[model samples]
Target: MSVRRLRNLLLVLIATVTLILYGCSDEDPTSTSSAGFAGLGQDVDGFQDAGSNSSLTFPADHSAHPDYRIEWWYLTANLEDESGEPLGLQWTLFRQALMAPSKRPEPTPWAADQLWMAHMALSQGEQHQVAERFGRSHSQAQLNTTQNSQAGVVANPFHAWLDDWQLKANDEADNRDFDNLTLTAYSGEGDTRFGYSLTLTAEGPLVLHGNGGFSQKAANGQGSMYYSQPFWQIEGDVTLNGETKTVSGRGWLDREWSSQLLDARQSGWDWFSIHLEDGHKLMAFRLRGGGDDTDQAQGADYRSGTWITPEGQATSLANSDITLTPQATSAVAGRDVPTRWRLEVPSAGLDMTIEAPHANRWMTTSVPYWEGEVVVTDHASGEPLGEGYLEMTGY
Candidate 1:
């Protein structure tokens, strides 16, 4: 069969398997069960687990990792008003696997292993708003067309986007460097809904996380490949409360993928990525559950990241050196979220408290969570340090 034709066939088969596991819903629910619409839990099987043996490549390597089970392109920015008050924004897409294609128990229409989710949020002063959406697809389809599955990195064009929110280089003219990118997003209804259409320029090189993208997540070798571009100078327009404003700031982009995310015993995680005033970047996270902060499986906590300098040198951070704590919780999207945090990195001589521009930015996805932009301040002196994006998943 032709490549396109074969691809569609695979998609259809996968979609069929997916229908058997996850029931389809246009409105979309936040749970994992397909929950009986049709085509789910009809078949079961076991197969040899595939192993990753491929070497990493640039540009293209920055693209998709479909062979694996999950991936995400995450972006968050910290902006300021004319009077210098802070604002925060976030846009992210997450892909997860319901089942491996080879493990189908039975075959039926619209069953597959692929699922996609997206979240967008905006925060300014005391206002916060968030939204989320989800969809499913087979790797192959009969008509050669699919629904809600378009995301990847293009080397030459230097673009990474999903659905409406995008980050693409403006290189059609002459710039080879992906120095300029456009970002846009919108949602909600009447005057209550809002979004931002903006441009971001690269001010520094991309930072690879955890030993050239091999980030360890659990003690058992469960982890992800991760990277980030944390120095994009941004400018654009934001529309909130039916009012549009010209804004400028810096943005950070993080990409991570893995077959296993949460340690099976862990209940949740609190993660932070900060861009410091001194031109260095700091990131840290803690997985909760399994033990009493002492057990390797249940109480065991894993944390590590890169501290990137302006000169482009990166230093690995150890768990013993960094500390993260939730300081406050507030209501968001019908759930309580810890929107305030205390972070410390002794090796970098840094201690700060991070707080959201607003407390309501929550993405209600297949796995609902809180992810948004935050402002950083000195923990001891209460001085403004810088800003960043914070994510709390599995809460």
Candidate 2:
């Protein structure tokens, strides 16, 4: 079958999965807090923990690891609309192994041992449009060629997808890094239509988070296999509110997974990937309720970051090297969410306050949360620094 045809089929599958998701939930949105706060942390029994010594390989590692309990392919962009207005967009596909590898279900027609979910959003000005989908598939289905599974990922021709929403290889680049990608996704109808068709070109090598991609999430040794392609130049067409515009800008893509990432007491986190005008980028995050009691950690949160230079040099920031403080809050989706913050990385000489242009950029997905583009300015001089994306959860 042709790639285009396969995507069309997946699109239909996505609609079916979306309707199914909406039918299952009428309660609160399941934010990241759902795992961190609501006491809904996944039971980690047979699944394997991401080890510190695990090596990350290309192409193969880009595909699904059915043994991990959870993993996600995430992309975020800070773009400019045709009219020069700033717009932000996000696309993410999550895979959750419902059963351990040892107990994985057979590839029977209706047997499923994995759950797939995808979240897509577009934010511009005060408007944000979001959609979420859910699907089920057997772990071995990805290996079969005859039947089309609900969702799966392949590495050689590098493609990660859920239904029709996907980030896939669009060129014949022999590079196993999967750096040349075309991202396509859409949802909603009428004036609420939203999605983007973008092409991303990698500008730098993939960046490993924390200690060579074993990103510790808590005070304890718990962590996830984390890495990112922090350098992408994006150009595409974004459709919103039934209008289409051509945009070009910078983008970031993150790939991570873990059996159990955060400790039960940890609340949520504030994650930032800022692109500075001065040939630098900063990636930082803080998880609440640090498991200090066991890890003998000193802080109340788990903080770590990477300061990436223009030439792709990465310096991992320890807890003492980074500080994040909320400066203001805005009521979004009936929750008072932090929309302003002071981000300090003294060693890097960064003391800036980031602020979201508007407080309404809330993703009302099945797992509602706040994510949007923000402007960075020097804390003291208030001079423009640059622009980037900010994601806050569990607030």
Which candidate wins on lDDT? Answer: 2
Per-prediction count of colliding residue pairs?
A: 32, 2
Candidate 1 runs further than 4 Å off: 1-55, 98-113, 135-155, 171-179, 290-298, 331-336
Reference-based lDDT, each prediction: 0.66, 0.80
User: What C-alpha RMSD separates each model from the true structure?
Assistant: 7.4, 5.3
lDDT string for model 2 (1-395, tens) is: 99767645664565456435322323332332334542224457798878798879886778888888888898999899778989899999988776688887667765778778899988888778889877667878766543368788877677777778888887766664478999999998888788999989999888888888898877667778999887999999999889999999999999998888776556678899999999799999988766465544443787889999988889999877888999998888889988999999999999999999988878786556788899999999999998988988777
> Which ranges of candidate 2 are over 4 A from the true structure?
1-35, 38-43, 144-147, 172-177, 291-299
lDDT of 2: 0.80
Supply the TM-score for candidate 1: 0.77
lDDT of 1 by residue, 1-395 (tens): 79656655664555455544443433222223322122211122231121233234666655555556667788888887566767788877766556665654343454555565667888886677777655444434211322234444454555555456666667453675455677778887779878898878888887776666666664545467777888888888888898778888888888887655544444557788888888888878776542234534435566666778986678877666667777998888777888988887788787789988666666655445677778899988889988788888655
| Model 2 residue 290 lDDT score | 63
- Residue 233 of candidate 2: its Cα lDDT? 94
- lDDT computed for candidate 1: 0.66
